[model samples]
Target: MKLYLQYFSMLVRCQMQYKFSFWMMVVGHFFMSFSLFFSIFFLFSRFGEVDGFTFPEILLCFAVVSMAFSSAECFARGFDVFPRLIKSGDLDRILLRPRSVIFQVLCSNIEFSRLGRFLQALLILIYAVLTSGFAWSFDKIIALFLMLTGGFVTFSALFILYAAFSFFTIDGLEFMNIFTDGAKEFGRYPFSVYGEGILKFLTFGIPLALFQYYPLLYLTGRSDRIGLIFLPLIGFLFLIPCYAFFRFGLRRYQSVGS
Candidate 1:
């Protein structure tokens, strides 16, 4: 933890040297993310709720997913750029360090720019809490906190799994965005809105729904099972297999000749 803080401080100092570039990137991310909000806004303005969900409820769902994705991207962008590290043989340095490779990779890069989206998510979350019609309580707060944390861990695990695949291909796969970015987009609505089969697949297979749908049902009073409120914890389980897969990939890593 101390080492991570040192790395973080150094990274912040380096980013400070390029304040213009950093702020521009932050603004860029803010606008890009706001596009999704506008899409939802226009939809609600016209039709006024879809699938028995109100605009405020939809905003809450969107904020949760966006917050998770933004948080993951802020700290886990290193995994997203893993292919570049491998291609340049920079990962060799990570292997040589006494620190854990995962920690090294995590500290390799941190994107404060992504916090623009995080702030946007937070603003929406505040509004959602005020207007979503669900009375907040201690348990509800805990459930929401768990959902955000679970979302961060789940999305980070996905990035780890995606990095593993890069070991075989020696190139970054764009299609993996179908899970990461696609999940954030579709997650604007509860995955249950799609259908039972899709919901089941998200719950048990990809586990994207672990942080979104079931717990939401409980939050909105649609489900009586209090167990559902804690389902997001299962997302943490996803990290074990993902880390094991990443280790398998590490064993297979082959350096290119300079």
Candidate 2:
């Protein structure tokens, strides 16, 4: 942990050296991300509700998804650019380090510009909580915290999975975005709203619904099942396969180099 902090400090100093470019990236992220919320606004203004979800309820869902994606992109940015690292052979240097390669890669880049999106999502989350007509309760608060945490880890796992795959293919894989960015965009509305098939796919296949949909049902008082409330924690399990796959890819890399 101390080593990570030291790495974080150095990265911050490097970004600070480029003040204009840094701020420009922040502002650019802010404006570009604002479009998602804007589209949601226009949609609600026209129809008043999406499939049975109130605008506020939908807003909460959107905020959670956006915040998760932004948090993942900000902290795990090195994984997002893993393809570039592999192409340039910079990944080889990290493998030689005494520390964990994941740690070194994570510390190599910190896209603080993503904080602009995170801040916007935070505001939306607060607004949804205040205006969504749900009374505050202990379980509800815990559920919200878990949703945020679970979402973060879930998205980070996706980033890791992306990085793991980059070792096999030098070309950029656009299809992977269908699961990462695509999930965030589609997640603007509740998972169930997509229909039973899509919901099943999200729930069983991707686990995105573990953080967004099931707990949301509990949050909105549709169900009081304690199991449902804690389901978001299942997201942590996703890392096991992702990490194993990464290790597998690393071995394959060694074989290719040999």
Candidate 3:
């Protein structure tokens, strides 16, 4: 943990060297994500509900996904930018360290700029909690906390999976955004609101719903199934396969000419 902090501090110092650019990037990211908010707003303006979910419920879903995604991007940014690391032969340097390769990669970059998105998500979350009309109980509050943590883990795992895949291709992949960015956008509404088919896919396949939709049902008082409130923990399990795939890809990595 000390080493990680050291590296993180170094990265922060580097970012501070270009303070204006850093702040500009932060503002740019805020606007880039705010556009998504407008998209949601426009949709809700046209229609009172989408697939039975109200505007406020959809806003809550968006906040959860956005917060999770930004948190992943902030800390796990190295994995998100793994193609550059691989192409630049930085992975070789990381491999030589006595520390765990995954840990080092995770610490390679820290995007302070993503805090803008996180702030936006926090505002939306506050609004959601205020308007959702459910009385908060200890268990429900705990479940909400778990939902945030679990969502962060699940999204970070996806980013790591994307990084792992990069080792084979040794290049950035655009299609992977469908799972990351696309999920954040589409997830603004509960997976169930999409369709039974999409909800099943999210639950059994990617398990995005494990962190968002199912727990949300309990939080909203739509269901009293206490069991479902803990479903986000299942999302953490998704990391196992993602890590395994990354390790497998590492074995296949052919160092680029230095």
Candidate 4:
């Protein structure tokens, strides 16, 4: 833990060295996300609501997904850029280290600029919470926390799976973005808005909806089932399979020989 903090501090200092570039990146990312927020605003302007969810309710879902995704991108940036590490033979040195590979890889990169998106999402989350009209209760608060945590875990797992695939191709798969980046865009609305088929796929296949849609229903009082509040926890189980696959790939890894 101390080592991780040391790495974090070093990375922060290195990034802070370029104040203008760093703040530019931060502001660029914030406005990029704000554009999506505008898309939602315009959609609601015309239709008022979609699939029975009001603007604020959908905003809450957007904020949760954005916050979760941004957090993952911030912390799991190493996996997101795993191909670069492989290409540069950094993974070889990482493998020789006494530390856990996952831990070392995690410590390899930290993207503080993503905090802009996180901050925007948090503001939207606060706004949504205040206007959405749900009676705030203790359980709902817990459910919201779980949703954020579970979503972060789920996206991180996807990044790991992306990295694992790189062990085979030595290049990152673009289609994997369909899960990572794509999820962030699609997730602006509840998964149900996509269609029942996509919703089921997200639930049982990718488990995105495990941390997103079901818990949302409970949060909004659209459903009375207490089990829904806990569904996000199931998303944590997804890490097991993703990690197993990463290990399987590690065993077969051949260095890029760079």
lDDT on C-alpha atoms for all candidate structures: 0.91, 0.87, 0.89, 0.95
Give TM-scores for every candidate, taking all chains together and pairing residue i with residue i. 0.97, 0.96, 0.96, 0.98
Best by lDDT: 4
Report how far off residue 98 is in candidate 3 (Å).
1.0
- Residue 22 lDDT, candidate 1, scale 0-100: 91
Expressed as tens digits, the lDDT of each residue in 1-258 for candidate 2 is 998899889989999999999898888888877898999999999999988888998999999999988998999999888888787777888888898888888988889988888888988999999999999799899988899899999988888899898878865578988889899889888988889999998887878999999998889888889688778888899988998998888888742252
Global lDDT of model 3: 0.89
- Order of models, best TM-score first: 4, 1, 3, 2
RMSD of each: 1.0, 1.7, 1.2, 0.8
lDDT order of candidates, best first?
A: 4, 1, 3, 2
Candidate 2 Cα RMSD (Å): 1.7
Over 4 Å off, model 3:
none
Candidate 3 TM-score versus the reference: 0.96
Residue range 28-140, candidate 1, lDDT tens digits? 98888889999999999999987888899889889999999999989998898999989999999999999899999999988898989999899889999899878888878
**Per-residue lDDT value at 204 in model 1:** 86
The 10 consecutive residues of candidate 3 with the worst lDDT sum are 186-195
**What lDDT score goes with residue 1 in model 1?**
90
Report lDDT (Cα) of residue 197, candidate 3: 96
233-256 per-residue lDDT for model 3 (tens digits): 988899999999999999998999
Q: On residues 130-178, what C-alpha lDDT tens digit does candidate 4 reach at each position?
A: 9988999999999999999999999999999999999999999999999
